[model samples]
Target: MTAPLLSVSEISKRYGAVVALEGVSLNVGAGEFFALLGPSGCGKTTLMRCIAGFETPDSGKLTLKSADLSGVPPHRRPVNMMFQSYALFPHLNVYENVAFGLRRKGEREEAIRARVSELLDMTQLAPFGARRINELSGGQRQRVALARALAPRPALLLLDEPLGALDRKLREETQFQLKEIQRKTRTSFVIVTHDQDEALAIADRIAVMRTGKVEQIAAPIEIYEKPATRFVAGFVGEMNFIEGEIARDDGAAFVTSFARLPRAECALPQGARATLGLRPERIEVSRDGEGVAGRVEDFVFRGEYTLLRVRVAPDVVLRVGAYDGRFAIGDDVKLTIAPDAGVLFAESE
Candidate 1:
């Protein structure tokens, strides 16, 4: 493995009594698109700020190419941050905004013009160089913001919820565009976002945070398929959680027994409490079959997919997918899950 472009080691931060981040560590390879994903107030932004030199951590170390960034100022560090709001100067034209960093560095007028022109072409905004910030659409403004951040040729780029300001349709379109731009530039990108789909779609690796801790760090597919904890299993996507006690654990398989469960699927350990996690999409529902009997409580049609809330045990209601089935609200259905499709999690104390 080559040396990481950026590495954060055991970083911790606190705001008086509230702990913002604790012992968070991550490594990003050169040119990799890494995402810090979590809900609001989950310390994703704080982590990004720390890397950008805007917020200093209380402990631990931040390194860029093996060099400490503790005392480095934001402008002096070989990093540039693209803010969520685009942060475009209202009074400056597109070219001037992209050229702002060059002006600060005291580059000659002719050199600034050439560098800005190249960036404009790189971002496909060459024709809009003369347009004012307010004149560009949301997607165009996003591109301008990206161009401005990339103009300085920073070794690493930090993005704070880069697509949060765009509407749904535009956000989806710009996600791919941003990935392409990152690949073209070959710059390491650390993006902070709360949208799971966005992280899964754009990032080479994702660090899922909760409260002030990283729950899991893995590729999108691995994180979605083999979540390490109950929090991760529940947070990453839709899941059916069935609670029971472990009847057996033989390393490979664990059986959990519930009152209504016909047989122990896989036991964990004798007397251990456990929960089975099955993704909604991985579950198969049939009109008539020998499986878990459940009554359809309600469902919503979502054009490309359907969501069904099925009442299984009296205490548990499972959310399942109905990709093509048209079972009515009051119909009974049998839900069958492939043994390998579910993961068993030990119940949290």
Candidate 2:
């Protein structure tokens, strides 16, 4: 395997009594699109600042390639960070904004012109180079910011909530553009975002953080289908968690709930407390009365699919995804899961 382009080993940071990052360690492969994902105050932004040299860690080390980056100034580090605000200078035109960093570094005017022109073309902003920053639309401003960040040709590019400034539709469109730009430049990107959908949509690998620590790190599908913990399963997407105890039926592990659920990966001993995570899409709903009984409580018609909330027991409500809204509220239904539908984890987790 090739060596990672960036490595963070046991990095920790604190502000007064607040803990921002606690022994966080991870690596970014060369040219890989990596994401630091979590809710607010989960240390993702702090970790990005540490990597960009804006905030120093209390302990541990950060290295780009093989060289240690400790005490390296932000401007000296071979990295550029794009802020969520897009931060383009209002007085400057798009071309001058993109050329700012190169000019600041004392690059020859000819080289700066070439680099800025190449970035503008690569970012699809060649025609808008002469436009004032205030005249560009939100998405255009975002592209300009990205182009400016790339002008220096850094080895790594860090983005903090890159699409936070745009509307949902534009953000989705820019996600593809960002991925394409990364592909063309082949620069390692570490994006910090609270939006799980955004991370899943663009990152090659996602590190899910919680309470100043990493909860899980894996590909999007693995993080969703086979979450390492209950928090990860619940946070990454919609999940129904059933509280139960592990029981053995014919030497096979099963979760004793409203119904016996056979799980192949249950490692706990018999009678151990556990939770079964069921994705809404994994549960099949039908009115044929062929599976566990439930009553539809409510439903939402999403364009692609319908989401139904069903009350299975007095205290248990499960969300089920169906292709159509065939069942209405107050309708009786049956829910069934595939043999390998759910993931099991300790209840304490």
Candidate 3:
């Protein structure tokens, strides 16, 4: 947000007839953990490659620390990339693998040793530096790759789904560890991920991309509570959408069939086509309540909570949460939308 650590200006890329990146532009601040989040084939990978100098853009400029990156090769740029596969050398021990880059840069052996030891200790790989890559668990191997990338202390570190290979439990734990290391090192990080939970849990800010363009760039809470587009609302979390036209009249706000929606959360023109976007937890389900009528159609037993699907209209089956087992399928119920809970988006967005 300050003078950016990295600046990407109107970058575009293509392959034959297909466009991989189209005028994508963003800025990464110093010591910020920024995330580029989207589904597969969304051009996040392409953008990362461009920053790493692995892929050149068809047009645009990239600058880091006020220095132009045009025509700069990957090795010459003050940036490092950690691949998803944890590209550790099988023949080298952990210490040697981490010290490889430093040695390549012609640092003295004593300085390389001290730096490698510090990094190994930081990543909790100090105890296993003498072991070969094959002898370590997946989590340990990941830490090794992370340490190797951080050894040189580059101004920017690019992580291409660095935890993709770890199991879910380990990945969750490592997320916090990664953040701690980034904090201690104070190095700017730009991570590429398709997992929404990962981005929300780890990033200082997120840029949600779709088909080569950034849809929204904001902190995790804003991206969830005030989505810039419908695609962002659907991609970030579990959301229910209902379409309607805005009406300022206190008398009639309906098309005669759907449940009455709350006042729009945003400013919209009178009679403009709009939509109500509410998260599942925003709706309260009860057997006898002063609200819209519906029936329990199905249920999903999620640990620590239960999810109920209530069909309130012919085509609208709103998913609401039910903590107790008081209701069953085919039971009549009332659905109440919490006051000041839903967000309104232009129907065309």
Best by TM-score: 2
Per-model TM-score, in order, reads: 0.93, 0.97, 0.96
* Best-to-worst lDDT order: 2, 3, 1
Model 1 stretches astray by more than 4 angstroms: 108-110, 249-267
- At residue 182, candidate 3 shows an lDDT of 96
Best by lDDT: 2
Ranking by TM-score: 2, 3, 1
Looking at model 3, which ten-residue stretch has the lowest summed lDDT?
251-260
Name every residue pair that clashes in candidate 2.
none
Q: For each candidate, how many residue pairs have backbone atoms clashing (under 3 Å)?
A: 5, 0, 0
lDDT of each structure? 0.87, 0.91, 0.90
The parts of candidate 2 lying over 4 Å away from their true place are 251-253
* lDDT at residue 97 of model 2 (Cα atoms): 97
| Residue 32 error, candidate 3, Å | 0.3
What RMSD, rounded to one decimal, does every model reach?
2.5, 1.3, 1.7
Per-residue lDDT for 190-230 in model 2, tens only?
99999999999999999999999999999999998999988
